[model samples]
Target: MGTWSARPFGNDSAADWAYELDEASDWGVVSDALRVAAEAVPSDLDSDDAVTAIAAAEVVARGLGRVPESAGSVDAFVARVSAPPPEMVALAVSALAVAASAEGELADLWEGDPEWLAENEKLRSALTTE
Candidate 1:
């Protein structure tokens, strides 16, 4: 179907980690990624790191909804998005879209899983359009 790249999202390094989460279907890993990212957030959260953190948090949020494990990261992401300029919001949303657009061999683990796919797409659309 379609190809996706994480370069546009900033911190391509984390993209593979994100894909690994989807590929492995491990919720524990989700908690870990988000926790690590959240712990790193400071008052001076860089736009690049913020984008990466938001993208990862979006994936966890999509998978678990309002999970306690991801609460801090999700909260951080929400705060960052809310306070940023329109362009920053757009950038964050675009990163989420890129993550949602994941496909091919890397995303095969999530393919045919309608619920998971829909959740990702729903979050992606909400960020991009709202």
Candidate 2:
């Protein structure tokens, strides 16, 4: 996570702030970067593949932290993440959102991603059964 002062975004709701942030930015560049960086992620992600994707996503998320917390920043961050399947995308978004927060900035980002952990477990289990 990058540096962000403890300043309110002048909005009453955090969700609203995040929504506005997403709408204000040009996310194409970020999306391209994410897609290109995550190109190595296989369709059937093993643990390592999942780790790779998560790492790529984290880099993008962390980069976004440098910008002010606004709709544009959210848009840029979300756009850069190349997670497919609505579930994976949601997971990515949630994880990124948490990591982008003040508390998350001070904590280990991946360690807080329960969804990522669950997904990893699911993938690992599938690998063993197959």
User: Which candidate number maximizes TM-score?
Assistant: 1
Candidate 1 lDDT tens digits, 44-129: 33334444445555544333333232324334443333233344344444444433334322234345567546645655554455
Candidate 2 ranges with C-alpha deviation above 4 Å: 1-43, 66-130
Clashing pairs in 1: none
Q: Which ten residues in a row have the lowest lDDT in candidate 1?
A: 1-10
> How well does candidate 1 score on lDDT at residue 99?
38
Stretches of model 1 off by over 4 angstroms after superposition: 1-70, 76-82, 102-106
Write the residue-wise lDDT of candidate 2 on 30-67 in tens digits: 34333432342232223222332333343333343422
Candidate 1 Cα deviation (angstroms), residue 19: 18
Candidate lDDT values, in order: 0.42, 0.35
In model 1, the number of clashes is 0
